[model samples]
Target: MTFNAVTFTVFLVLIAVVTVMGFVASRWRRAKQADRLDEWALGGRTFGPFVTWFLLGGDLYSAYTLIAVPAAIFSMGAFGFYAVPNAIVLYALGFLFLPKLVSLAHKKGYVTLTDFVNDRFGSKALSLAITITGLLATLPYLALQLVGLEVVFGALGIGGSGSWFVRDLPLLIAFGVLAAYTYSAGLRAPALIAFVKDGLTYLVVIAAVIWVPIKLGGFGEIFRKGGAALAGKTTSTLDPAIAVNPSVYLTLALGSGMAFFLYPHAITGVFASRGAKTVRRNMSVLPIYTVLLGFVALLGMMALAMGVKPHDGNPQYAVPQLLSAVFPPWLTGVAYAAIAMSALVPAAIMAIAAGNLVSRNLYRQYRTKPVSAKSETLVSKVVSVLVKVGALVFVLTLDAKFALNFQLLGGIWILQTLPTVLFGLFTKRFADRRALLAGLLVSVVYGTWAAYQVKSATGGPFGGSTAKPFFLDSPIYIAISALALNFAVVVLGSVLARALGAHPRAAGVAEEPVAASN
Candidate 1:
């Protein structure tokens, strides 16, 4: 099918308008001091409830959610439902948990989760480890966002021709715009653009929900046709862990529930709120998006009706392909643009968050002296560009399937930090810094090894998925399991350290703020 050139043009015009709006965001929240890193990176920590809600939603749903959920359903059938529940669980957990994190952040003037890690563990090295791990994990996450944008462009016929260079033009342009505003306005850009992105995303999601059914007969019909084929043809269904294992499901739900906010970029959104109250209020309301997610996940079922298969070269293309077939050229163009916009906001946030880690944690650690605020800010901006470039390499070199799976692998890797970042927020129980380090190392190896063991098809003991269950057969989130191992090691190590009389740091660090929102 062909695109509605006129509609596509109008969509581009709207995105460009929003892009410029983001560029002016710094001025919107400008304080008297132009050079303040706090204002630049944390949006002056002054966003009210509405902005915080949209910003957090935009950050969370993102291009990944927009594209990946439906793609999962299109490719993997019932397994794809995990993403929808994961999102709901995340929002629900945030509602119950975020206010405290936000309160502590506000009180402490914290700009990143690493700050909290440093304060809680009272260990610079552990914080530095978190900082590095977060940057590494998020870089590919940023690349996946770009891949989302590229899929939309390829679907909508946005570029000159179908060549790789042409298809990728939108990604390059999106990256440039994101980098420019993020450099100039920092968190303000994403904070402001969140409104546009969330607004468009909500509208597009609702429209697709309504339109897809009408276009494809109905939801029941679509599901009936699709579910039957999927049940038999899928790689494996017997292994509960790999397919629907209860333990795997519960672990994934709980692990992601715990780790979602622990992600540096995710916490960055919380840090930008005006106060803890705003976070709590927003949390109460954000579950409304869970409704949208239900609809969004259904798009996968719709894709099945349309016979949307993962492209040989690009798994990311499934959603866009499904949408293009289900909608008129014009509406499809709008949907693609909306998804592209979704990619831009989160990519910018991840890049900035990652850059901040490098500049503040790693670079400053090695420097002769503390870097000036201006230098800190400048270094962040420079590395943001470099990080984006590195992500571009991932996009170019890795197959889309490999990239997506590897990203999930990265999540498993980063989840190791949950104990140090999230649990450490409330108490100092496992007070040994060395224990934290050991836990982190254990988590990394265990999670990666588990992911390596998972296979596409289920079979003999060794032949099954990377997460070869000493027990189950399902798509248990590898990252979540890794986190458990990380925490367990920390517990064992702390026990040993205490018994061995390893001198504790003497309550050695500056006191951590007692609240999540400062």
Candidate 2:
């Protein structure tokens, strides 16, 4: 795994170019009074169909999608490929609700999901809970991106076999560049860089899907060998199996699809769009990346066919190592660059979203006096830098395997907000603020306890994310089960409150007046 100078050189050049572009992006749209939170955090809601497409696509098909999805396939076989259907259903779900969200956000000047929750229920407490949950969920997700970057560095032979700092020096440097540009350009940085990330990703993936199969004889031969290898394994857990557990598969796909747009980063991307038309167009078009993901997932099968094993216990390295092993140093460099940029673009957006969550929801709530728009944007920029740094620290200290579990756990936490944010959008009955809080607390507690009971290969409770509750036949995704519980609590609690004649304090101010657009 010695570093190839050719590959390393190419990687550095691409990194340098992208870093410069990220900084330059601050001026790309050139919004007047860029100091406002809307301008800085949402790109002034000016992005049209083309830029919105790339931005949201880039946000969704992250390094986690490129690296971790393949890694999951490599390690977990048919179950890991659940990401394919999950992505398709995710867009289908998005098509139904995201445009409405975009319209509401534009009409109300809402920059974060918490703002919507606050306005809908007129409860600062509910808004604060939503804000805290978003920040907590987003941090680990941001760390997962850093883990993706770390995998790239490890694949390049820039790390490992060294002191801790030496191994992590490259990551720190990469994150420093990310933080700087993100602070300067905000959402625009990732929005512009998404073009380059998506282009490189498509080129590398298309080449691998085509070239790797021919090199290995054919798709038929590759699968035959892959199946043989899996069949020889003694353990059911680690061994590759073509059959997916129907219960697990369906829950994961449906639960994750529902939670996709609920993510702050996804909402941030949507809010940046120019209109509902832009949101709808992007939703229709984003599935092309899912097709690309299908091809990328095959890289895991290719690795299996070649009998390539990851150096570490982490399966996340499977795709990166496969690319380095199969492609020339130069093309591998380009591929690594693509994967690295995939990490950067999403990390930047997640940080920005986290920052916005804090500034708009937390910071403003606590302030004694009104915070000017300029002041809010400044605080968000500072907080954005801090968020990236925190993620860098998190990835540096935690096990890479835990990073994946953390992301899954994050899905559980974020999904709890759906009862309030998603359902509250269309109905006032579900707008009971206290019920929202009660549902959120119960779901999180149950999900965390369930996750804690599921032991990991790493030999720790809470180390794995999926668990079955109430002794289901097949394991259910904890998030889905938790969400069901949340909905029940919301409904039952809303009923009891009304039965007692306890009017929600928020009910008086719940509905935002909608003006007719000419």
Off by over 4 Å in 2: 234-243, 456-458, 504-509, 512-518
Number of the top candidate by lDDT? Answer: 2
TM-score of each: 0.90, 0.95
Q: At residue 126, what lDDT does model 2 achieve?
A: 79
Question: Candidate 1 — which residues are off by over 4 angstroms?
Answer: 1-3, 158-167, 231-241, 309-315, 455-466, 469-475, 506-512, 515-518
Clashes of each: 31, 0
Model 1, C-alpha of 383: deviation from truth (Å): 1.5
Minimum summed lDDT over a 10-residue window in model 2 is located at 234-243
Please list the C-alpha lDDT of all candidates, in the order they appear: 0.73, 0.84
lDDT string, candidate 2, 1-518, tens digits: 56899999999999899999999999998887888998989898999999998998889988888987777667666677888899998899888877887788898899999888877787877788888888888888999888888888888888776798888899989988999999999999999999999899999999998888888999999898877765664444431222356777888888888888888999999999998888888889889888998998888888778887787656777888888888999999999999999999989999999999888888887899999998899999999999888888778887766766777788999989988866666775545678879999999999988887775542664665566678576677889889989999988888777787776564423775342231
The CA root-mean-square deviation of candidate 1, after full C-alpha superposition on the true structure, stands at: 3.3
By TM-score, how accurate is candidate 1? 0.90
Could you give candidate 1's per-residue lDDT for residues 198-225 as a string of tens digits? 8887888888888878877888888987
